[model samples]
Target: MLLGMRDDEEMGRITLAQVAERAGVSISTVSKVLNGRQDVAAPTRVKVERLLEAHAYRRTTRSAREAPLIEIVFHELESIWAMELIRGVENVAKAHNAGVVLTESGTRHAPGPEWMEAMLQRRPLGVVLVFSTLPTEVKQQLRSRSIPFVIIDPAGDPDPDVPSVGSANWNGGLAATRHLIEHGHRRIGIVTGPEDMLCSRARLDGYRSAMTMAGLEVDPDLILFGDFHVEGGYDRATEMLSRPHPPTAIFAGSDLQALGVLEAARAHGLRVPQDLSVVGYDDVSIARWASPALTTVHQPLRRMAEEATQMLMRLRAEEPVSTRLELATSLIVRKSTASAPTGSPAGRGGARS
Candidate 1:
């Protein structure tokens, strides 16, 4: 009954019951409007929304607003790369006085509809997606509910309307390739992520660009495509090294892949930098722990995650944010690479057991 009366008891007190009464509707109807539920009749919804704006019926309390909860979804939860991204998001969430919820998609790079349904039910302040994509229907649902979202290192080409944060992958690839070229490696091999992934394509393009600039004929026999994982790297490296004229150096699309390459070298009894050189992308923590610390292109995965969270915060506050953000990538030089051997021996038939 505390509609618009000014009294000490009712001061700044606007409850859903009062709103429902004033709008000539039930409390459930008011809830439907608040939740952006489409089941309600258009006229009833319009009346309820109009009254809500007039009386300013905020759904969140002061405490809830102060420490809003946010959600981050990822394709997988394994590996140091994912951990670094999580740490970055946690840091920003702490600074913003927000709490974070993590969800694993449990599927291919795209989050399924069940994940969207859960997110809608929880109604977090905003969402951050890493290496995942949303379906058009899910995007519409989020929009109807006024839930903002940002993507980090999207698995594919994101919708133009979606906001995203990523590193300069092409530049990273180019730099990694050029570093080997500078060290006198002409027959350089490359193992990249899936061919369908945008990041993989960009990195591969960058390598091609660098090779073209150096006037090195890209050897089709040395280029391989696989997932950005250790196994992929191992398989690709093993196959390439067993060729008739194996590459003197190899560029892996990820740190995990680089480790696999190292294992492949060992299995072949070839010493790193002595028989072959290697470069990797994403200077994850494990890179430093590798035998000959990885020479890599620093993708700044943590920074990208942090920036994406900040952008989501801005969106949650109804503030402006850039549609897309690209952080700079740098080359981290380590001991993994060396000048191509003066008298390179022909490739053996295959790696040793």
Candidate 2:
């Protein structure tokens, strides 16, 4: 009877660990219940929550760390685009004297369970996910832990509750296509990334809109899906060039793909701007260094990264942040694009007239 009374007192002054023991579950399970995670079974959640309320258990809160660190996660670490993002974030992070930790999830745009577990264990001041999505349960856990996070260039349509930063992809695409149209090229081809990607879809829509406004038919054959890689761009460009009615100009989804397109034209003994014109997206460093400086849509990747970092800092301060932020995009015309050659769709065919 004395032991039973002591056990009751222990349950009454419960900590998370003690709550877990009383509920016959793991510490993480108790945490899930407290975080309001949807994955937990309804009955278990209810029972655990009831016990928590009965005990008047309040989670212990800790003061903010003196030297808080921020975590930055990437889908892929390669490419000038990723470098620019890192530079931007580092610039802002230094200003706040916050240490930055960078990690890559291999080729995946989303972090795995292991990554999530480690993140929860470390509990950084804030997290920045580049071109990635956060699962609902993970978001809940972060919220419960008082960890703030921001998504940069979300891979797809982000949840309404998720804060995100991105460029005006549709406007960039429209401007690129319009530049080609104004150059008198009616046989324009486009190589875009996976259709499931929101940015890809938006760019494609922008391309179609520009073509429609110019009263040009958008041939299904001229639109190709690519993996947003150099090899994919080369292969797609090669295949399109072999078509019976090939395009006079091409828009590659990324600068790396544009480089491949350039190589593909070279393999066919076609001179850039002379025989085949090309335009690219994301005016990374290579865009300017290419033999014929690339004509591209500048997505302001660095600025976007900096903006996302600033927003995350604000979030960590318990300040309100805008749910969506979009940076402007501009078209940079270079030597890569020119008027269509003779006998091409917009040349002797008189599409320009």
Highest TM-score: give the candidate number: 2
Lowest summed lDDT window (length 10), candidate 1: 1-10
* Candidate 2 regions with alpha-carbon error over 4 angstroms: 1-60, 64-66, 106-109, 154-156, 344-353
Model 1 Cα lDDT, one tens digit per residue, 1-353: 11122342355746778888988889998876666566889899778766666654555322232227788888888856788888889999999787888988756556766677667557777888875456665555555445678888634466566898877888988999999999988899999989988888999999999999999999899889988889999999999888779988999999899999999999898888777899988998888889999999998888988998998878766677888888999999998999887764344333444
TM per candidate: 0.80, 0.81
Clashes of 2: 0
Against the correct fold, how does model 2 do in TM-score? 0.81
Q: Which residues of candidate 1, in runs, are more than 4 Å off? A: 1-67, 154-156, 344-353
